[model samples]
Target: KIFEGNGAIAVKLFPSNVNVTTTLALASGKIPWVEIYADPLLNRNVHEIEVESEASKICIKVENLPHPDNPKTSYLAGLSVIQLLKQLSGGTNIVVGT
Candidate 1:
């Protein structure tokens, strides 16, 4: 969805050395309202989580760790969903086997 909306994909320090301030590096004023960007100084891999809403001019960013084995995959991709469902099912940390 993001790629389709932006019509461009900016990738850096991906599957390689992650250093310095990384970003989407999109064209000037490319994004209509808000654009998602990520540059983790410590995390070698990351996912630039961003949301856009023209109706309210809302842009949300939520970065997450990449797959333990592969930096390309998002760690929260599946774990987050599982965690949310667990929490909704009366699950708790340490006590309920979160």
Candidate 2:
């Protein structure tokens, strides 16, 4: 079955999939308009975000391969979390992007 809706509905129906939206809302201080789609045919997890303002417009899209041992989560996502932990622990002084 395929599911589609706004962020609130996505949260209710698919809590595990709303991490990006939650992070965006926290970082931007605004709840973003969101569209969620559940497609069984897709072999990879895909996320797309677009933001526009008076000064600039930003668009980002990421397609992540599923982890070999854990099909429910992406391999890249796991690596990202590890990297974040490392950064938070002061393992690196370099910071990229805002």
Best by TM-score: 2
Each model's lDDT comes to 0.43, 0.82
Which residue pairs in candidate 1 collide? none
- Model 1's alpha-carbon lDDT is 0.43
Compose the digit string of candidate 2's lDDT tens values, residues 40-89. Answer: 89999899999999999999998989999999999988899889889787
Q: Please write out the lDDT profile of model 1 over residues 24-68, one tens digit for every residue.
A: 323334433223345546473433434445655543445566778
Off by over 4 Å in 1: 1-55, 80-98
Q: Estimate each model's TM-score.
A: 0.32, 0.74
Who wins the lDDT comparison? 2
Q: Please list the Cα RMSD from the true structure of every candidate, rounded to 1 decimal place.
A: 10.4, 6.8
Candidate 1 — worst ten consecutive residues by lDDT sum? 12-21
Q: How far is candidate 2 from the true structure (C-alpha RMSD, Å)?
A: 6.8
